[model samples]
Structure formats: structure tokens, C-alpha cells
Target: MKSAPRSAVLHRMVMPGHTCPYGLKARHLLRSRGYEVEDHHLATREETDRFKAEHGVATTPQTFIDGVRIGGYDDLRRFFGLRVADPSATTYRPVIALFAMTALMAMAAGYAADGTVLSIRAGEWFVAFSMCALALLKLQNVEKFATMFLNYDLLAARWVPYARIYPFAEGLAGVLMVAGALHWVSVPVALFIGTIGAASVFKAVYLDRRELKCACVGGDSNVPLGFVSLTENLMMIAMAIWMLLAYGM
Candidate 1:
């Protein structure tokens, strides 16, 4: 003897201009869980509103199992023992991903140029690539980045325009470093910004004991302003010194 398959009823939005994503997800979930779904599409705004008002629910994609309401998509997920995301949780995933990607790029570049993945040049490339990537993120919205940067950067606080200019300087230095050219220009640029950045991060995070978001990844980023930020600046400073010693006469 075998038990019959579970059955579910789903009411979801399917408007002309906008189909509800949660509704689609709910339908998919029901099918995947071996439920025979009787899906009802509220195809118009009026119909959707009527459905909501009648059901006394504020949101759509409502589900029913065994003649009992199972609520919306999130509710359905909970019923299935799925993990729901916490919107306010802090994470270091962005910086971790950035560093990982840059390391891989550095290794690839090393292999392409010198026929080996591990070398002094690979280390240099890693720093240079990271600088370029960070600069790109900041450059996406310079004004936003400048606002966030002014919070901790001593130089930016004193000279407001430096906040805007910082990304370009970092990017130019990085490009030059990667090319192994124009050491005269790149070395000074990297040293100046890196020194100021390290000092600012140390003062804000260590000395002043303030917890804040990092502008290193960009203004909107949730990445914490602390060790990772300091490391970025230190790497830049070290790279500048290394390039100067290796190329400067």
C-alpha cells in the first residue's frame, strides 16, 4: 500500500506588466516537494487586491495545504525547514571574494608572463590587481564613496576633494605597477595614499575605538572598517617600496 501525493492550493499574482517572482518561486517549490498544486492566478490588480482583502492577508503568493492556509513564500520555506535570510546580518563575503578573485588573477598573470604561478612578480601583481579592483568599486559612485571616505580619512577630512581624487590615484598607480612602467609616477602615488589610509584606519578603528563600514570596497558596502582596510593600505605601501627598490636607480 502507498500513500497518495500531497496536494496544495496557491494563489499568486500574474499581472500584465509585472509577474510576481515569489509567486513563481512558490509554484516551483510546491512542484519540487511532490505536491499537486492547484494554482490560481490573480491576473489583474483589482483581482489581486480582492484576493488579498478576502483572505485578510497583506501579501500575495499565499499557499494552502490540507485546507489550511500556509501563508506566503517565506512561510512555505519555513514549513519545508529551509533557512531564511536575515536582512540585517553583517558579512565579510564581499572583501573575501574580492581578495580571492585578485589572487587568482595574479597567479594567471604570472603564469602567462613568467611560465610559473609562484614568483616575486605574482605577489606584486596580486597587490596591483587588488588596488585596481578596489579603485573600480569606488569609482562606480565616486560621490557616495567620497562621503563614506570622509568619515575616517584624515587627509580627506582636511581636503575634501582628495576623497574624490583618491580612487583615480589608486587606479593609476595600479595600472602602472601592473605594466612595470613609470615607477617615477606610480611609486609616489601608492606611497602617499597608502600611508594616509593606514594611519586613518589605525586611528579610527584602534585608537579611537569606533566601529564603522569600510569605504575600501565602496560607500554602500557593508564591509567592516578594520583589519581588511588596514591590510589593503599596507599592501599598497609595500608594493610601492618594492617597485622603487627593484626599478629605481
Candidate 2:
């Protein structure tokens, strides 16, 4: 004996002629879940409610599968015959995580450099020539030598030693300090050096505030350092100690 096959009904109230956005969303959702059923779109809201009532369906997108009812969109998804999108597949990696970190460290070092200078802000500009201390200690590290001449205003961005401009200047200052000529030229030297230093730091801070990049040392080494504090003072002190020995000779 062959029994009558059970029929499943799908009731929708979507307007006709206008593509059902919900139906489209549902299509994608169902397809993702391996559901290959065709959707039913209603021409009007009234017709959809009427169909629901007649079929004892409770909501929109109401599914009667093999004569069993499922509620709404969410319910349909749970009975999904499709796979879900992988959350991990959409995640991303940080682009500038390491770069920003390294640049930040440079900024910190720059700040410390400025601070140490001002702590021993000597009125006598001649103290700068004391940088001759480098030769005495035989410290040939480019960065350490450059630190002696770090004038933020001059070196923060626009200028770099293409052929040892700073090294030459440091040597000149060292010679003058050694011969005691720096004492006579102390005012002008101090004014020049301090002005350059103050400007350099300010420029770095300004660029940092404006998010501008620094181009120092013929490279793109932009970083920020605020006002000079105890850091630069210590640098000056170290230079001064060396100058005392340099001058003694």
C-alpha cells in the first residue's frame, strides 16, 4: 500500500519583482550551510501572514521540512546543511608592530640625551670643546662621537654629516679648547652650540607632535625628544672630564 507523501511549505512575505534582500541573505546563509532548498517569496505582507496561519507556521522564512517545522532564520541556520565561515581566516597581523617599537626606543634615547645635557648647562660655552675627551679615551664609536655634537636643532632633521661635518667641528672645538682659544671665543661658541641644541630638540618634538618623519644621518631616522633635562647634562659632564685631560696635554 503506497501512503500519500508529506508536503513541506515555506511561507515568505517579500514583495514581488523587487529581489528579496532577506532571501538573498538567506540564500548565502543556507548555501554556506549546504542547504540547497528553493526559497518562496510572498508578494505582500498580508498574503504571507495568511499563508502562515493556514499552514500553522509561526514566523517568516518558516520552514516545514519533511512535515517538521523550524522557526526563523536562526533556527534554519542551526539545521544548516552548510559549513560556517572560519573566524581565524578573517584575522590579520600587525603591520608596524616591530617598526614602531624600535622607533619608540630611539625617541626614548634621544630624550635621555637631551636631558643629560641641560643638567650641567654650563654658562661657559668653552666646556663644549671639552669633547676632545673622545680622542683621549679612544672611543671611536660613531654614535658616541656623534652624541658629543648632538645639537637637536642642527641634527634633528635637515642636516647630516655627509663627510664628517660634526666630526670636523668636534675636532676644531677640541683644538681650540686644547690651546685655550675657546675661552676667548666662549660666548659665540656657547651661543651657537646651545642654539643648535635647543633648536634640534624642539624640532624633533615638533615633528613628533605633527607626526612628521625625521631625516637625520642621511637616513630616515625620525624620532621625537622633548626638552633637554638631566640626560644631556651627563653627556656634557663626560665630555668636560675628557676636555680637562685633553687640555692638560
Candidate 3:
């Protein structure tokens, strides 16, 4: 039997600025292959650039299987083909997007009044602020969001990362929403916001058996199987089905 080749991943671990999105996803992809992975986060732009120049890595998380560069996360995904997208293995980008969108939008609307799109409240700000967070999660792992309450977390503790970062970002969006910063057509804005969140949640869960994890209260979420959580995601799923049906129609 031919032995499996050893592999490693190197990611520049920095917060609030770096493109760790694709990098982390790549690492997760490699992890699924049972390879020896090593991640190195570039702390400074100079370091990252130097590493990039040194290794000819235009981006990260760059993959090295026995000292060979294989590009970033999407490349690795293609390398692993559809296998890494499986929850039973590694990589869950779709699921995370779905739940994250719904949760962030709901929290954003929480600080607004009926018919008043923008107000001097926290909820409004959170609505806008969630965009960046949403982008990051999708950039990392959408599959996890799709199958949060499934077999993936059974072997990993990051079913919920310790980073209570989402809640804080939501707070920022809520502040903006309430401050009436986004008062330019709030209803449609809210709906649009909700739609993105819904789509993210729907995609994530659908790819992972329609099972879901309740993304409430940020990282410390513990609201039980409440009606809102169930409906928010289900509505997203329904919307997705509608889109699919419309397209197929």
C-alpha cells in the first residue's frame, strides 16, 4: 500500500485586517486529509509580503504537500474536490453563512422601532456592522454553518469558536441602525439584510442535512430551540427553495 503524503498549512494569523478567510479554510481542507499541518500567521504586512515573495505565495493559507505550494483555500478545495465540503470530513462554509446572516440581522433589527428603519439605537448599527463579520465567516467556513447541529462538532470544540467577536460586531451594527445611519429606505434595507443572512443560513444548513445550530447571543449563545431561531432559518430555507423553484421554473 502506498503511504499517504504528509502535508502542512501556513496561515498569517492576524485579527481585524488580514485575509485569514481563505487561509483558514485551506487549513481545514488539509486537516481532513490526515496530513501534518502547520499554520503560521503573518503578524505584519512586511512579514507576509516577505513570506509571499520568499515562497511565491500570492495569497494564503498556502498549502505545502511535501514542500510544494498549492495556493489558497479555494485551490485546496478544488484539490480535494468535493470531499472536503463534506461535514463528516472537513470544511463547512455553506452552513455557517446561513445561520450567521440570520442571527446578525435579527440582532440588528432588535434596536429599531416599527417602520423606522434608522433610529438612535443599537440594533440598527448591528445590522450594518454584520456585513464584515458575514464576509469573514463565509471567507472561512460556510459548511460549518450549514451543519452546525450535526456530526462535525462531535469531534471538534470549535462548533463554536471562543471568539465572542460576532456579538461585538453585531453591537456595532445595531448602533448604526438605531442611529438612523441607514435611514435611506430602511424596510428594503432590512429585507435585503435579512435576505443575505437567510441565504447564508439556508446554504449552510442545506449542504449539511438541514440540521442547524442556534446562533444566538454571539459566541455565548444559549437560547434553546426557540421559535425565532427555528423560524428565522426555516424562512431562509423556504426562501432558498423559492429561488430554486423560480430558477428551475
Best by lDDT: 1
How many clashes in each candidate?
0, 20, 44
lDDT of each: 0.94, 0.45, 0.48
Candidate 1 lDDT, tens digit per residue, 1-249?
979999999999998898999999999999999999999999999999999999999999999999999999999999999988765665689899999999999999999998999999999999999999999999999999999999999999999999999999999999998998888999999999999999999999999999988999988888889999999999999998888788763
Name model 2 segments beyond 4 Å from true. Answer: 1-9, 16-20, 81-249
Better of 1 and 2 by lDDT: 1
Better-scoring candidate (lDDT), 1 or 3 = 1
Model 1, position 206: C-alpha lDDT score: 99
TM-score of 3: 0.32
What tens digits encode model 3's per-residue C-alpha lDDT throughout 140-185? 5444433443322221234344123333333343344445444333
- Compose the digit string of candidate 2's lDDT tens values, residues 21-86: 555566566556545555677888788778778877666777657667765666666666445444
Q: Where in model 3 is the C-alpha error above 4 Å?
A: 1-5, 15-19, 83-249
- State the local distance difference test value for candidate 3: 0.48
The positional error of residue 208 in candidate 3, measured at the CA in angstroms, is 40
**TM-score for each predicted model, relative to the true structure:** 0.88, 0.27, 0.32
Of the candidates shown, which would achieve the greatest TM-score relative to the real structure?
1
